[model samples]
Structures are given as structure tokens and as C-alpha cells.
Target chain A: MALKRYRHDWLYSFCSVFSMIAFMVPMLTVLGIKDGIVGTLTRRLLENPRNREISPIGTRAFRPEFFEALITHPDAEFLVPETREISATMNLIAEGYPSFDGDLYSSAPGDPLLSETLDPQALSHQLALGEIYVSQGVAEKLGLSEGSELTGRVGRRQGARNEYGRLPLKVMGVIPRHITPKYNVFCSLDLARMTEDFRSGYAVPELGWKGKEKGSEIPVYSRFRLYSRDLDGVERLRLHLLGLGVDTLTQAAQIKLVKDLDHSFTVVFLALFVVVGGGAFASAASGSIDQVVKMRRSLAVLALLGISKLRLLVFTMSQAALTGFLAALGAEALFLALAKTLNSYFGGSMGAVEEVCSLSAFKLVAAAAIIVVFMTAASGCAYTSLADIEPSEGMRDV
Target chain B: MDPSPQKTKNGAKEASPPDPDVSDDVILNCADLVKTRKGGVGYRLLVESMTIGRGEHLALIGDSGSGKSTLLDMIAMVLKPDSAGDFSFRPIGHAKWHDLWKIWRKGAYGIFEALRRSELGYIMQTGGLLPFLNVADNITLPADLKPGFPKAEKRERFKALTATLGISHLLGKLPSAISVGERQRCAIARALIHAPSLVLADEPTASLDPPTADRVFELLLDLCRDSALVVSTHEQNRVLTGRFKVWRIDCRPGGEGQPIEARVAPLKDRAPAAALPAGRVSLAKSLSDSVH
Candidate 1:
């Protein structure tokens, strides 16, 4: 009993140990890689214009309460993409900030800021009514700091500066100086609504175009970019807004391709687990059977020496558990080291996206659980061998 | 009321106390102990009555088809009897005859294994030593397997076994590396190292050459001088001496509507007035009638 559990034929030993580690390490590695990819794909999928667009389906215009209803959805974030020409100076009263030709942007803060933007968080704060965040170019030209105010004139695109009304806005913050085309201003919807030009509602937008009939008389949005908190529900929200006779700008093929990629990764992970898990289990079971067949005489000898069937069974189970434990240790060591190396590799490539090539607590737990299941099947073989063994050779089955 | 009871002499009429490991006078008593099996062919083994005392050696002999091994296994409680009657061994509470050992009748195999490990030792034809273990480990195996069997005295007893068997220098070698005689000597050591009262050796010397077999048998008989040794073998010439009694076990195939028949009897030598039992006389005649 002492040597039996630890001792194995070279072939059996190599096969069992190799298969165990093979099952654990590669499965975990694939899962980590899948998670890294899924994280990126999910983010990109949600950030895609196809998933975030909203517009009137055809000739129909939005109802008076359509905007309010869409905004009330838990996942929905309403945005007005219309830009109006404005001329402004600093706060209500002061020596005044340097005024410049600045284009104003009005939208919710959670919008997917362009990847080309060097400092994404520079405009991370939400814009309140009567407040604004200026890009670095605008900030430098106006010489505005935090708590400074800018007086802007909002009117027709060709309206004269003195012809427009004065719109006083506070400069709450400044965008960092990195991204190009930095003369942009960010403000809330309420601030945009205060402008007389925007107050004159425009034509309702279609799926991809903001236009009105040659002769029509109804309030319409030039364009609106819609967003959902979770991409899983984004399609449903899109359908809801589309049901309201709105056509959203969506590349269904691109979104489906990303979603299909996500599903493929899931299938790969599961298939990898089954293939590896099945191989490990088969190796364990065969190893157990081989040991029993080759060591029958020895087992009978032990039985003759008075080791009970139960102890013999436990002895066999210990071998499997020990094998699994040793394999897990080796696999984990290899897994963690590999994850670290690949983490840096992925980090170097995907900038600012979290969770690149990292393992989860659940994977370790799953590996342990799989090892236990393997041991259980292996020990079952041993138990059967014990049950079949007779105390002595040439003895009749009784 | 005396706590310690009196021990009878060898082959005594009465059994000794429960603790027989230290006692010299001990007896194993049985009446009508029987064992049987049936299949395409049938087997019925029986021992009408018998007693084995400490320092007594019995050589069980028979023809090629005789049930010598079966008889030895039955005596050691390795095989459950077809039907057993009025049997016990001493000392009274020795594990071999304890309440647990009674499970042999109920087919409680674990109890029989425990009895074998702690109370009796078995030596099979092939040495029955585990291949992976070295000579020393095989010798001490029964001791370790026997729970609560004086674990501290193992080293001392092992040293004694090595010295007695003259295999001390070969302790570290695997069974594959050893000579046949050396292997058999190791088997004998393994049997006696645990201090079992009864040592059942089936063909202990059957596999050795004549010269090596002689030496191995002498060593076994010598070491078992203080214990109850029952050896089953075909080496009748070597065991014909007065120091050892011969027990021949024979099985006669039964006819239709009748049970398989078997018999056990003492094979005595050179007694003109002694007539063998009628059923056994003819088989005995061919042996005794021949000149030695």
C-alpha cells in the first residue's frame, strides 16, 4: 500500500500528469484570452454608431412626447447633435476672456468620446445648464480657467454677432490640450435650448439624414444620437424607438459580426473545456484500470495480508487526488506566469481598455472542481477493481 | 477467582488463557470443522476433530489432486467452510478465535483478513511477497498491517528475523534481484516476524531445488519450533521423521444423489497393529508398501 499509490509505470505516470496539467492550463489560458477579446468586442459593439443611432423611420415626424418617453427609458441617454454658430466673451462682467471662433457641442456626458481624443477624461464631467467645458484651443484663446464665464451669441448660422441675443455661460472646466481640432465647446441640452436658433425646431431626422419635406410644417430634430447603458438591451431599446416610427442609423451587419464573434469565443471556450476535460477524465479512468489490471496479484497479496477493501479503495483514491493536486499546482504556476506575460503584451496593444489577459476567481474554482470530478471517476474504477479482487489466486469466485 | 488461568502442556486437553503470545502451552480445538464448494465439479473438505499445541508441527500431505492447500486455507480461516461445527483456537481471546473471527462462518471477510494479519501468517508457493517492496519491507508488512500490534517492537523483531533467515544483507534488494533460496527465506521471515501463533505454509519448499529446498525447510521447521506450524508439501521424504506428524487430506468425488465426500486422518509409520481406515488403507498401502 505504501509504494503502490506513489509508484506507477512510466507510461501511466507521464500520461496522467501531462493530461491533468494540459487540461487545466490550456483551458484557463483560452478562457483568459476569450475574456480579453470579449471585453474589447463588447465595448466596441456598444460604442458602434449602428447600436446608438435613432431617427424618424420615414416621412413621419416624432410625436410631441416622443423625446420625453425615449429619455425616460432606464437605459436611454438622449443627445441633440445640432450645432449653432455662436460668438461670445467671458463671464457676466470682467476684463473679459479672449473670444474665438468656437463650435459648440450639445450632448450627454456619457457619449463615446472619439478614440482619437488624446485625453478622454478631460471632458468627463457632466455639463449643467448655464455651464460649459471648453477645448484646450478655445480655453487658450479665451484665457478661461475654472469658474470663468463666457457670453455667447446664439442665432442663425449667418446671423450677425450683434443681431443675436447674449447667452451667458459659466466655464466649469477645460478639455486637455492633445486631441486635434480642439476649438470645440461642450454644453448641456438646456443651454442649447436657450439659443433662439435651436428654439426654432428643425425638420425631423430620418435614419441617416436630417431633412424636411419641400413644404411641411411640424417640429423635427436635425439629428439625435441615442445610447443605452448596456449593449445587451440596446437592441431592444432601438426597437422601442423604431416602433415609435423612427429610423435609427444602424450597420446591422457590423453589429451582428461583432456579436457573432462574441458567440464564437464562447463556443470555443466551452468546446475547449469539453475536449480537455474529456481527455483528462479518459486518461484518469484508463490509468486507474491499467493499474488495477497490472497490479491484481499485488492487490490480492495485500488482501491476503489483511488490508480491507475499504482501505484499498481509499488508497486508490488518494493516488488520483494526489495526481490532481500536483497537476493543479503545476498548471496554476504556469497559468499565472503566462497570464502576466500576456497581460503586458495585450496591454501594450489595447490602450485604456481594462481586463486584458487576466484570470478570474471563477476559473480557478472551475479548475479545482474539474480536478475533483476527474478524481471521482478515477477512484470509481479503483473501487470496482477492489470489489472484483479475491483473497487468493486460483480461488473460485464466491 | 484467579485472574490468570493455568496453561496446559503442549497438545493439552484444555485451552490456555486469552493471551497466548507469551504462553508456551496452548491448544487449538475443533470438532467436525467442515468446508465445501460446488460448481461443474464439487469439493467437500472436512477435519472431524483436531488440536494443535504450541511447539507442535504438522505436515499435511496428499496426492496431486488432494486438497492440502484448501485444508491449510480453511485452518487459517482464509476460506469459509461449507459448514463448520464446534471450533476455536487459543489463547481464548487471541484475534484468531475472538468474537470477530466467528465471522468466518458468516462470510465477514474483513474479520478473517484481520485474523490472518494479527494472529496467523501465511506463506504461499511463490513467496507471495509484493514485487515493489524490498525484502525487509515484505517481512515487516504484516506487522504494519496489523493495527495496534506492538508497533514499537518491530525493529527489534525485524533484526531478529533478518539474522535468523540470514537475509539481512539482501534486505535492500528487490525480489527480482534475489536468488530463489534467498526469496523463500524472506518469505519465511515475513511469516514469523509478526509473532503469529499459527504459520500456514503451502508448498513453502516446493519451488526450490533439492539442496536449497532442504535448507529452506530446515530453517522453517527450526524457526517454527516454538509456534504452531502447518506446512503443506509434496516433500514427504523430508517430513517423514518422528518430530513431525503427517495429516493426509483426500477428496473423493461423490455419486449422483450423494454429497461430495472428503476425509482427514493421521498418517503414522511402521506400526504393524495399526490399520488405516478402510477408505484410506488402499491409498496408504501403495505408499507404505513401497520400500524407502
Candidate 2:
């Protein structure tokens, strides 16, 4: 019966349904654009793997226990110990290229920079006792490639005398320029420790270089470079390192910008929803009131026919519910079309993984539910007129 | 009008009180029912005594503003009387009589609504068919409101009634699409479709032409053979020629500031007695079954 009434007054019903669609589609579109834009920006920030790296600004002796505890930290993805800046440099000479100095750093398993270019297990295997990995900058400067033989010479000032140690090295791999943009050389922890010891005027029996005999000393690292498990973990790891009096540098500001962008979009969307949604609600409610007033004769006839007042109320509300549900469906279809158009228009510039407008399936369902509920409430606001229709009014000549 | 009129303190004539020994054949009995319309030129309608017998045909005739519609509304229980000395109704085949005024005072509107659904039917002057529905749906609405009305029986009656009313062709059309005469016939069909024990038609043909009004009025009277009927109409000649028991409202004009007073009184001839059809079902039993 309610459906019959709705169908009988299709023009009025159409207007009400369209009003609801007008309210809902804008809200859904704004939300989708917000999610898409913010998601794309955040994804762009995460594209550079180095953005997840946290390195201390200056040097300090960090104990073995500190390294062990830091590795157990929840956000720590990868960590490697480094020697002092003075001993970390070496003069490299390749057969076909001019000699140049390369900054040395320790390399170990799960080194994200090397793992980005080569498999982690393979990279670990290649970091043997006399092997080294060179950055693309170093490779370009010294004319180095994998399997190329090179000589790394370290010179030390020994009380007005210049002492030099030479080590035979093979270029095991070259890290990508994007991963390590500076001219640097990477070697195993044992090799880096030996270099630091030789620079401190100690003997390195492995290279048969002469100096003071080695003594028992607990090894301490002057610096460490760590990568987080993900982009979001960078700030957490940086803060954790800061708690230990070490100020670390990472791309936390870029991540904050994305968060702020999300917040701003939400506020703007809410304001739009309040204004447009209020108007739509008023339109739908007043339209329902007008329809009920026009149909009071028919409603009174039903009452005169002995249909309960409660049933009459249900009849009126059922029509509103139908209108709301239909509007939600219309809004969903419109939103999908708009989202597709926007995504297509912007998809060329952004990568395939990023969309300019997007909404999750869960959000779509939730929006539909909310629209239906809202429309029903709007109808409820007009129930007084329906209830006031008297059955005796059906007796009048009018 | 053989009964003597007694004068009230306000100088209005009051008809005799209702008969205390109501027989089993009587359907409704009322006495001393009063309703006051409070407004400029206040009006009051008084029904001193009245009775509608089972299978009886009664016509209410009066001038305009004489409270014919008000009296009919009160009898139909749609309008509550301000006070009642006695108002009782016995549904056909029911052993017990229901106190109509007591039910009203209790605010038991559902009972009144259910009675209207299962036992009484009303027809308005303008053919009060729902505009959204087709003629067929409008006619079947009363039966549809009944919870367990037999669909096969309803269909059979619908065909017979529409055929009888000459409205079989207009069943698929909406009320707005039909003529006034056709709509009136449709209203008659709706009022009789449920087989109610009482049918009230208030100027059912007042909007139709002479021939159509005659035809519709005759059809309404003919189809109500097995039920009681109270019809209010201006077609006095036809009603009198049909030999229906006539009730007229007599109003006394008010003075400059006083309210007008009116009372219902029986006219000369009672309707000719007719035999009841066999196997008439009790409206109470039907109502009870349909509701519960």
C-alpha cells in the first residue's frame, strides 16, 4: 500500500529521492578524494626507502649491550655498527681508473641498502674477509665493478712518521646510487674493525702489517645507522634513539604533513556535510509533509476503512524508507562514476598504485546505511500531520 | 408522528425514552444521546430515542444544518456523543449486547475500529474511495483490512457486486479516472463487499445526476437486504416511495445569543418486515476470528 502511494506520486517521490542523492554523493565524493589524495602523498613519501632510515647526527661510543637492546627495539628493522670518521676512510686504486678516497662503513646481513640491490643472503655471503661493496659513486670514481681487484691503503700518523697498511680487496657488489649517493666503501665487520685497529697503531696479522700488538678490548661503536620496519616506524625509532641523548634525523616532517593534510580534508568535508545535509533533510521532510497533506483524504479513507492508526503511520514511514534506500543506491552509482572519471583523469600522472579518488567497500556500505537512517528520521519529523488526519474527515463532501 | 413531545427546561422538545425490553431481533437501541457543537451559533443535536432492527432499512431526512450527518456520525461511532443515557448495540447473532457509550468512555477505539471493519460500513457523499488505488482495490479495502477474510469468497462477491452495480468495467481504473456516478457505485460496492451487519450511507448519490442517483440509491438499498441500513439523503420522494422507515431531525432556531436545538423523531411508516436469509453468520464471531 505504501509502495502504491509512492508510485502514485512519483514526481514528488522523485524529488525527495533526488534531494537525498544530492546530499550523499557530494559527501562520498569528498571523502573519496580526501582518502585518495592523502594516500597518494603518503605513498610518495614512502617510495624513497632511505626515508625510513634513522642515523645519529654525531659520533659516540655505544656499548655492545646498547646495540643488543637497540636491535630488540620494536621499530628497528636493520642496524650496522660504524667506526670513527677518521679510520672509516681509505685510498682505493683500481687498475683502469684514478685513485680516490672512499669512506668505509660496516656491512652485515640484512643491510637494507645492499639488500635493495642484491639478495640479503647473497650479499652476506659476498661480504667475506677480503671483499668489499662499493657505492655507485665509488664505482664510478674508481672504475670498480663486481669481481674487480683493488688495493685499499690506509695511512696512519705514528709520532712524526707516516705508516701505511695495504689490503688486497675484491669488489663484491656495488650499491645503487639512490641507496648510498656518496662515494663509500662497505666491508665486513671484522675488516672494518681491523682497519680501525690498524689506524690506532695496532698490528693486523691478517694483513701482516706491523704496529703495536693487539690487546683485549671490548669493541665499542662510535656511530650506527638503522632502518625502521616501515615508513611509520621511522618517527618512533627516531624518538626512541633521542631518549638516549642522540638526536636522529629522518623524514618525520614529511609524514606529519600527510597526517595534517588528512585532518584538514576531514574538517572541510564535515562542514560541507553539515550544510548540504541539513538542506537535503529539510527538503525531504517538507516534501513528505506536503505529500501527506495532499494525501490526507486517502489516509482518512483508510482510517475510515478501519486500518489502525499505527498501521497508517507505518504506511507513511515505509514510503520514506523506500525513498531513502533508492536515493542511497543512486548516490552510490553516481559516486562510482565520479570516482572513475577522477581516477582516470589523474591516473596518468600518478602511478598505477595511487588513485585520485577512492573509497573502500566498507565505507560505501556504511554510507548507504547512514543515508537510509537519515531519510527515515526526516520522515519521522512529519508524522504529526499524518496522525492528525481524522477518520470522520472521509465523510465530508470534499 | 404520534408520540407526544415532552418539553425540556430549555424549551426544546424531547422524544420518548428508549424501550427497556429490547427483543432479540433489535440491532441497536439508543436514548437521551446528546452532542453539542461548540462554536459561534452553538448547535446541539439530541436523539431522545431510536432503534435499528436487524435487516431494517431506515432513512434519515432533514433540511441542511439540521444535524443529519452529525446524527449519522454518532450512530456510526465515529463521533463521540457528549453524554448518553443509554446506547447499546447487539451484533447480529450475538447473545450479549455491548454498551456503546461505555466503550467510548473507556477510550477503547480499537474495538470501535474493529467493529467498523468487520460489522459496519460507511459510504460518503463524494465517494470516499482512496485516490491512489484502482476501483477494484478501493472496493476490496474493507475485506483486505480483515485479517482472515476468505480471498475466494471476496473475489466471488467482488465480481457479483461490481456486476450488480454496473461497475465491472471500471475496476482497473483509479477513482480519479472514473465518473462521479461510477465512483458512487464503487463506494456502494466497497460498503457492501465485507458483508457487514450494518451499512451507513450518508448521501451516497447526492453528487450524481437524477437517473444515476436513482440507480445508485436503488442498488444500495437492494444489496443491503441481509444487513441493517441507515441512509441519509435529500431524495425523500424516492425513500418514501421505497417504503423505508423515515427519521427526521427537527431544529429550533436560536435567539440572538442562544444556541439552536435539534432532536431526532420517527416519521409515520415503519419499514415492511422481511424474512432473514438462512445461515446468517454472527458478526461477533467473525470479528473475534478476524482480530485474534
Candidate 3:
């Protein structure tokens, strides 16, 4: 007959809101960190193909034997020759470059130096045939189409030289301009192989009696470039190659850069986790405590009215869980907004920012932990308050 | 005067005096009841040797702190008697029915077991209705707590009491929404709903206006006609003028007693006392017939 009043107390409402915020902070923080890590990893995975083509630094030369061995490694797909030189050359037809009027000669077609038209199959056959493919940049500069003839002197030729020296050659084909417009070229391995003065090879004299010997007398030198499946694999493969008396300075350097980036990511993740997780836990705990205290009188009244002590405890816990969940959502939204604003201000690509802000399994785990912590804290407070309420005392005017 | 008397065949008159050897009519008895309280350094007796019959109205009156409330609480079973004192009662055969009904009706035992049964009801100085429950719910609280009563019967009882107390209009209002007089009326209605055999009222009319208090007292007496009524009060005029037998607890020290002893004596006997009042006569006749 004595019904309980169902009116909401302002103090309790305020406390509940506070508790929710507290619980949410940690959950959101953890979620943010998890999202950021997973996002970065996913973006890296998605962009890996594009990123792999551009070496962080400049190119390094390798020996014919090294190339042969590297191509045989399990993860290595193909080997291509790349010659590096700085020059201003452009696709006059494509409209980005207008100043250059004269033709340009850089690297050969099918070379890594030429971003486009460096076909693996074509380059491998050409290396076998001792022919070179001219870069698109060279064709564009010279205003020459495919199969055009061109002449250029090889400066700083490291190997032996032939008589009547500035070599004349026929351009096999023009590469597309999107790969690289500046200093772009692809050449057969024979070009570098023929230069005997180069540290890793024999000179023109070593090519031996140029007219007397056929193409067989001119040794076909191979260049090796190593590619790895993963950065760790790269390091292990580099070590193995170095142990095998092969040169790997460039490969080792690239692996070192990747390792450094990984270490930096670790430090950043740790810092974020501590800050966010701690903040969320503190917020949830404070809010839960306040709520329990605020509802003490109501709890006492209910207890006297024949509601069991255990039921009250469960009720409070349920309230805490609900509040924690809501608060986590709010905090996550805020974090996302902040991440977006930061990304915009810094002019960073949205892909990376979005990846970092994405929620994942780790974020869910963090949110759950926050809820558990809040419920535990709330139950503790409820227990203390419940212990203090005596039925006779409750019936009296407070 | 000889206390034992025999009933006639019709049971309408006291037929003849009982033989001195035969003794059994008295169903409830109390002897040399002494209640004490710590006063400064010494203890004081609050009530001494108070007794009542099966169907008598005994009005207890005193000034504040005179232990009237304490005595009522003792009789109501709300408080335990001190180890040094003794109190006892011989329950009648129908008392078992009251006990069974109290347990069956109230699923859980009320703190005041004896007062809850024995057809005993209490009206406090201030009406204690649960604030959230309406007047009707407050009145039916006891019956609702128990089982075994048919719905129709309960409804009939509820309707009769509400109409008799002139509170039918206020049945739906919460206790807080009603006036003090109405709240008191509701409390009285609740106490009489079960037709208790004994009603203990502690300053039931203390907060009511004189007219309201008189009306409440009259209603209380009418409803409790077949039961014993004990009211502890500070109001001298209300008790002195009432038709019920009166007991005044005087705290003044007397012969062979402490300073706080209670001396209970009958009010001055009047010759040709007003014939049994309308409600009382019928109630007495029915009770007399039942006893015989």
C-alpha cells in the first residue's frame, strides 16, 4: 500500500551525469589509442605499393652476381637496373613542363630510374640482348617518339671505354610521364656492365679486343636489387646477404629507417594510452562515488520499505554501467572531433587521420574496462551506505 | 464487592452471585504492575497495578511525563517490561482466532503482536499514514498485507468504514494532500477496520480541534463498543466527562509508595447513570448473549 515515490532527485541526476563523464573518459581514451594504431597500420598496408616504389633516399648500385642472387630470394619478385642523375626534363605534350626546348637524354627505358615504361619482362630480355630502352623524359626532351635515334655522351663512365666514345643508340620506346618526369631513365644492365672503370666491374680493356671478340667476349654483368616482404624480414635478409660476402649498405640503411619509425610509434602509443586511460578511469570513479552518495537517502528509504540490500546494490551497478557506456560514447565523439580538427589544421591527409580515429577491438576492450571500474567503485560506495542504514533509524525523521 | 457473578438462562441479567468456591469468569487479569524509569539518580514507578476487563472501556489520563504514553506502549507490546516487573494476561478462547487472523492477514508479524491482534488498535498522537499512499490505501494497509479475506468482503468492510467516517470523498487523496482532521479520521478508520477487541489511543485527539476531537472520540467509542478501549491522554475535560470508566495516574508520592506511583481508581459513581447509550446498549446486549 505504501508506494515508493518515483520522482528523480536533482542531486542524483547531477551525480549520475558526472559519473558517466568519468567512466567515459578512460573508455574514449583507450578507444582513441586503439583506433589510431589500427588506423595507421591499415593505411600503411593500403598505401604500401605506392610507398615501396619511392626509396626514402637516393639509389645505390649493385653487382650483377648480387642481382642474380637477390632475384632468387623467396620474397624478391623481380630485378631492374636504375641509374640516378639530376636533370630538368619533362613531357612537353603533357603540359607541366614548358621551358625546355631541347631534347633530353637520361636513363634507359625499363630502368628503375624511369618511373614508367620500366617493364620487368622487357628489361630482362633487353639486358640479355645488350640493348637499352630510353626513358620517356629523354624522348619528351628530344621530341622523339618510340624507336627514335639519339646520341649522348656517358659522363663519369666508371668502366673501360670504347673507341670513338660518345655512344649513339636507338630508343626502344617512350615510357609514360606519370612515373617520373625529372631525371627519369631506364637502361640495360649492359650499359653499366660495359663501363669497366666502375668499381664493381672491368674496364673497356677488360671487354677485350672490341672488334676481335663477339658479344660473347663482352661479359654480361648482372645488377642485383633486394626487396623484402616486411621490414623485419628485410633486416634478416640483409644480415644473411652481408654474411654471404654480398654488399648491402643501401638495404641496411632502409631497414634502419623503418625500425626507427616503428620505435617512435611505440612511444607515441604508450603515451596516449596512459593519458587517455588514466583520465577515463578517474572521471568514472569520481562520478560513481558522487552518485552513490547522492542516492544514499533514497537507498535507505527503499531498504526500510522491504527492498533487499542486494537488489539495491544491483540497481546501483546497473545505473553505473549505463552511465559509463553513455559517457564513453560521448568521449569518443569528442575525441573524433578533436582528431579531425587537428588533421585539418595540420593539412595532413584525411586517410591517416581517419585511420587513427577509427574504433577497433582494442577500443572496445578499453571501454569495457572503464565500465567495470566504474561499477566496482559504485558498488563499493553503495555497500558502505547500505551498511549505515538501520531500519528503525530510517523510520525516524532524519 | 464480590467480583464473581452468574449469568441467567436468557443471559440478559446477572442471575445470581457465584458460589465462593467456583472461579473462572475473568479472562484477562493484571496484578501489581510496576514500571520504573531512571529519574536523575533514583528510579520512579510509572504505572502500578493497572487492570482491565474483557469488554470494558478504561480511560487513562495524566499530565505530560506522567507515564501515560509509556503505560500504553507497554500494554500494546511495543515495549518490553523491565525484568524486575511482572505482567500477564489470560487470553480468551476467541483470542486464538485473533492470533491466527493477525498472522494470516499480516503475512509478516507486526512489531506490536498483542496490539496487532487481541482486536487491539492504536491511534497515535499524530496520524502516521505513509505519505505516498492515498487515504483509502492507508486504511486498508493491514488487510492488504494479509491474505484469506475475500475481495467482496474486504470491499464491503472498506465501504462501510469510509461512509461511517465521512471520509469517502477523501479516499483517493494522498495523506499529505488531506487536512489534519481528515488524516486523523483516516487513522481512526484504519484502526477500527478489523473491528479490534481492544483499542489503545495515545493522545488521539491531541492535535484535533475541540469539536473534531469530540466527534473523533464519539466515533472511536461507537466503533469499539464490543471491545475494550484504553486511551492515555493529558486532556482532563475529555476523559472526566466521558461515560467510560476513568483511571488517573498521579505521580505524587502516597502512603507506602514512591514519588511516581500511579493510583488508578474509578471515577465518581453516579446514581441512575444515563441508561446505556444507544450504540452501547445494543453492543452490550449482543455481547451478553454471546457470553451466556
**TM-score ranking of the models:** 2, 1, 3
| Candidate 2, position B62, lDDT | 68
Worst 10 residues of 3 chain B by lDDT: B6-15
**Predictions in order: lDDT:** 0.65, 0.82, 0.51
- Per-chain TM-score, chain A, candidate 3: 0.54
Chain B TM, per prediction: 0.78, 0.82, 0.71
Which window of ten consecutive residues has the lowest lDDT sum in model 1 chain A?
Answer: A203-212
Between the candidate structures 1 and 2, which one is better when assessed by TM-score? Answer: 2
State model 2's lDDT. 0.82
Tell me which residue pairs clash in candidate 2.
none
lDDT tens digits, residue span B90-123, model 2: 7788876777776776789898888888878888
Cα-based lDDT at residue B292, candidate 3: 58
Give lDDT tens digits, candidate 3, residues A82-157. 3332321212222233423222322333334333344666543443222344446656656666666555333332
Runs with alpha carbons beyond 4 Å of true place in candidate 3: A1-3, A8-398, B1-35, B39-43, B46-56, B84-122, B147-150, B193-199, B225-229, B241-243, B253-259, B262-292
True A-B contacts kept by model 3: 0.05
Candidate 1, residue A374: how far the Cα is off, in Å:
1.5
